[model samples]
Every structure is written in structure tokens, then in C-alpha cells.
Target: MSMFDKTTKMAAVLKGHPKAKEVLESFGLQCSTCSGAKHESIELGATNHGLDVNELLTHLNALFDEPPGK
Candidate 1:
């Protein structure tokens, strides 16, 4: 039961998780300011950025375990 996967849209991820921007930035993805974030899926972004999609998803899903303001 992961909170996000390859098909998850960047916009949806940002909206769904409070720390998504931070997490994304850590992986070198400046999604918050990118227009493509509106329609780009995690998989696409990762591929375009030369990142490992599975690694990104792992970090993104880890956010689900944190307390709401952490």
C-alpha cells in the first residue's frame, strides 16, 4: 500500500503530501516550479531527470509514515 507510484502525477504528489516539495528537491527534482508538474508523472520526471524511479517512490512513500507536521 504505497502512497505513490510511477504513475502518480507531480501535482497530485505535492498536493497530497506536505513535504513533497522538499522530498522532490532532495532528489534533484524542482517540481514545484516546473510547469510540467501539472501533468508529469513521477516516472516521466524521474526518467527525464536521470533518476531512479523506484528510489524516488521509496522516499515519497516514506513521507506517509511521518506525523503531519514533521
Candidate 2:
């Protein structure tokens, strides 16, 4: 299972994650400047922006994947 799933909140993902913000931008999610953007879930944001939730999760998880030997 991925650490950050589709139901994960956008703010939580972006928090302390500059790379996440960049990835979201690359995915064409421009909600950072909008009201309640931080409160939106990943699925909600992706759906509202006409993006594929699974694909977005794939990209996001890649950016935040945990390393082995932890």
C-alpha cells in the first residue's frame, strides 16, 4: 500500500513537501492558490481538475515512497 493514498488530504501531502507541490503543479493541479485547496482530498482535487486519481497517486507515491531497511 502507498503511504499517501487517493483519500489523503492535499494539505497533508504538500506540507513539508516542496517536491509534492512541484509534482502537483506538473500534474496541472493549480489549487494551491485557491480557497480551501489545502482542505481538499487528493481524489477531490484530481476529479475537479479532470485528472486521473490513480495516476496522480502513482506520481505522488513515487515522490514520497519509503526506502527499504527502515
Q: What is the C-alpha RMSD of each candidate to the true structure, in Å?
A: 1.0, 3.6
Residue 17 error for model 2, in Å?
Answer: 2.8
Please give each candidate's TM-score.
0.93, 0.78
- Model 1 has an lDDT value of 0.93
Global local distance difference test of model 2: 0.79
Task: Give the per-residue Cα lDDT of candidate 1 at 20.
Answer: 88
Residue-by-residue lDDT tens digits, candidate 2, 1-70: 5668877888788873557787889988765676666679999999998999999988888765655532
**What is the Cα root-mean-square deviation between model 2 and the actual structure?**
3.6
Model 2 TM-score is 0.78
* Global lDDT scores for all candidate models: 0.93, 0.79
**What is candidate 1's lDDT per residue for 1-70, written digit by digit as tens?**
4789899999999998889899999998999999999899999999999999999999999999887777
Please give the clash total of every predicted structure, in order: 0, 0
